[model samples]
Structures are given as C-alpha cells and as structure tokens.
Target: MKNLLKNGLMLLTGILMLATSCNQISDSESGGNGKIVLSLTDAPFPVSLVDKALVTIDKIEIRSTATVSSTTEVTTNSELFTVLYDGDPMEFDLLDLQNGITTELLSMDIAAGSYDLIRMHVTNASVLLKDGSNFDLKVPSGFASGLKIKMTPNLVIESGVESEVILDFDVSKSFVVQGNMKAKNGIKGFIFKPVLRATCQKYSGSVGGKVFENATTPIAEAHVQIIAADTILSSALTDAAGNYHMIGLPTGSYKVVCEKDGYTPVTVDPVVVKAREKTTLDIQMATATVTVNP
Candidate 1:
C-alpha cells in the first residue's frame, strides 16, 4: 500500500479537484455550482510511547441532499460523488495538525445543494515509535467502504456561495489496539479505526482551561474531554501546568471531563461554547479513597 501511494500510478490517474484556494463570492455569484472546500484538522490523542501517527488519505466522496426547490436531487445512499482532491497521496502526522493549524484537502465547484454525507478514504496509516521504529497501522476494515462521517447538520451549498467544512480527525480515539497485550503488536496489531466529525468554521468554537488535583496541585497528563449531546467533540492532555485545550468543536452545549490515573474523575457540565468563540472550564479531581487492610 505504501508503494501504491508513494510511487504508484496514482499521480497519472489522481484527479486534481481544487487546490488551496481562499474563495469568496457574492450572493449573485452563488449559482450553477457552489464552491465547496475542505480542510483537514485534528484533535489531541495523548500517548506516552507513540511519537508520531502518520496517516494517508487518498480520495474524498460526497453525497448531497436535494434542497433546491426547482431541481431534482438524488436521495439514495448509493449516490456518491468523488470530490476531486487531485494530488499525490499525502501523509500527515496527526499530532502536528493540532490546536489551530490545518491543511486544505480540496476546493472545487459542485452543484448547489445540501450534502448529507462526506467520506474520506484513508489509504494507509503507520506509526513511528519514540525509539525510531515504525510499523504499518493495520486497518481491519472500512477503508474500502470509506470512513463515513455524517454531517449532523446538512452542509448546504448555495448557488454562487462558498461552503467549507472541516474534518475534525480525532486521532486519539480513531486508532485502537485490540486483543491481548501479551501479544507482540498488541490487539491483533495496530488498527486504524477512524473517528471523525464534520464542522464548519461558522459554527465551531474552542474549549480550554487548567486542571487541578485540588486548589494547589496542578494535574499533568490529565485527559480532558469536551462532549456535547453525549458525543465527545474533542480531547486534550493537560500540560505540565495542568492546562488543556480542545479546538474545532461545533458550537453547542457541552461538558468538560477531567481524568487522570490515581485520581477521581470530574465533569463540568453545562459548559456552553458559542460560534467562533472560546469557553474556559476549570476542573479539580478529588483523590480516590484508598482502602488498606491492616
């Protein structure tokens, strides 16, 4: 698979849809085809041993919902259009594209309508250990079917309007190891189970704050999660100062959860993040009571 992406014949056949473009059009220009753009972003996945998580994406697909009053639309599940991302397959380190940075996936003109689904083809995934060793991040299945990420709110492409969607690739939750730890590769090997969410810049916000064991002790390496509607939006690891931040969350009511080894977990509920804004939620973990047998 590595050879297929790196030096394969993909370049000759790879369709170049749209390059990095900052496109804007007036309400008048938004007809015929609406400009659609996609950017790749990631959420935190904290691990001690794994140094780098490199993932490769080959193609992108889209299925639209008919919103135009006059035009006919396809509502069938099998109806999918390949959004052109013409280029050599790109390998990205999930850890690097965090906080705020992102890479453009594609920008092209598509028939104006509302899109219900966006799928990404992750051709390959591999990890680099801290010790400079590397291995293929095995995928049990789903690559052929594509990583199906549902746009909770349908993505509308108005005539002459520019629409953009950001894929919040959660690396921490996406990659999983199965089976017994007693084995060599851990769970049948490193499985790339992708976890992703679609959010638009117009509707997303960020969450950040410091965590504490109490009023005095800062909690480092704490797992901080931001969840909305029972779904985890993003997660981060508290730094040395117990500071953590989760970005690219679709604006909504959410809860912040803080957890660490040997400490009691805490959740701060009713934390609201407005569009294009940041919400701060501080947390404190009570120590777990220890039982001793004399």
Candidate 2:
C-alpha cells in the first residue's frame, strides 16, 4: 500500500507538469505576429542645379499598411507612418505633396495589413530670387507638389515580416533649363543658360565650433548661423559640447556666425560646402565690455 501511494503521487505530479507545458506552448503560438517593415529606394541621377547648386537624391517617400486580427487592438494612430525632409517639418497627410513620393525623404514603420496601393508624389522645391545686386535666393513657402504614384498588385504586409519598394528613376536623362545669354545683336539673347543636372556622389559634411567664456571652456545654447554669401542657409544651437551640425546644404561657400547674450558675436568665414565632404568650422565668442560714464 505504501508503494502504491508513492507511485500515485508521482504520476499525478508528472501529469500536472505535462499539462502546464502544453498550456505554455499554446500561449506561445497564440500571440499575434511581429511588425512589418517597408523600405524605399530612389533612382540615380546626375547632380542638378537647384539654387545654383548641384544636388541629387537617392530615395523618395515610403509607406506601409497592415491588417489587424480581431484579437489585435490598435491603441494609437502613431503607428501610421509619414515622411520628413532632412531639415523640414514632419508631414502627416499621406496624400499631401510635402509627404509624397518625389521627396528624398521616406516614411517608416507600417503594421501588417492588406494595402491596395502605396501612393507617392514628387516635385521640386521652388526657389525665389530676391531682387537687387546681391541676388539673394530663398525657398518660397507652399511650393511642393504631389505627383501621383501607384504600385501595381497591391503590397501585402504579413505579420512579423518586412518588405521593400523601389522608387527608381534616372537623372542623367532628365534636364531643365533656366536663364538667357546675350546674342550677337547684344539685345539680351539666350546664350549662357543654366542647365540643372543630377548626379549621385558623396555629399555629406559637418560644421561645428566652440562658444567660449574669454576663450576658455565651452558655452551652451549659443546661436550659430551658417551664411552663404548674402543668404543665411542654416542655423543651430551649441550643445554642452559646443558642437553643431550644419546639414542638408548644397555645395557652396558658407560663413559661420555665433551670437549670445552678454557676449560679442563671433564670425568664421569661408565655410565651404562640398560633395561627399565634411567641413568643420569652430568659433570662439568674446566677452562683452561695457562702458559707463558718470
């Protein structure tokens, strides 16, 4: 009888353990699948003139969609993806030009679902030329356009999967003309026209420096402006490291200027923007001296 009781207890314990293991296996397979990733690639082109600078982009807009199971609950719209320019603001509308496919920027993160088509729009950012001898150039507001893009055979997003889409185009074949030249009659004929081209090359760099207290130690939150000729191209704030990145600029010359309260402004000249290059410019701010007369 003692042996039988011991055997019964052991059998019960083994059965319980087996039941627990089976339950765990079912739970492991019950949870929904993982997220889907969509990537976009742009077509190659020759460097084209924009604002008198050569530029090229590798990719445009990217978007994704996913179908949720009845068991899955979506808590927020944040999962819906969007695109943003390097220095531009975030775009929310999937149909708007600013968020469309023509831009070098692309969207990321779309859950698994059934999507009919991923739409994209591409257009050039408009440039406005300021009058006078200086010829200051400015990018006007609301100048982007969305050209429609349709992908065939609707993309499928499976749970726990990723996908990629290509937005390819050739730039060497694409060209645009601007400006006119003087003719033999000297009546302002079209002779020297500016042709814009696009090419893929190494076009990346950085600009940074220090804002100091009497040339010692770094200062934080100092305003830095990158100027190209008469134009203020970009700006950044110095961090605790007294560093900043002047990004998304075309090949050209620039000047770095730093300003802060209770300090004299400092300027660094001839900051060049080059293709596939990184340029560093550092500046030191001077303490302001006050003159008081009684």
Give the alpha-carbon lDDT of every model: 0.62, 0.34
Q: Pick the candidate with the highest TM-score.
A: 1
Q: Which candidate's lDDT is highest?
A: 1
The residue-by-residue lDDT of candidate 1 on 218-249, one tens digit each, is 98878887765676656777767888776657
TM-score of each: 0.74, 0.36
- The true-versus-predicted C-alpha distance at residue 27 of model 1, in Å, is 13
Give candidate 1's total backbone clashes: 9
Clashing pairs in 1: 15-86, 16-86, 29-160, 30-159, 30-160, 30-161, 31-159, 31-160, 178-187
For all the candidates, what are their Cα RMSDs to the real structure? 7.9, 24.2
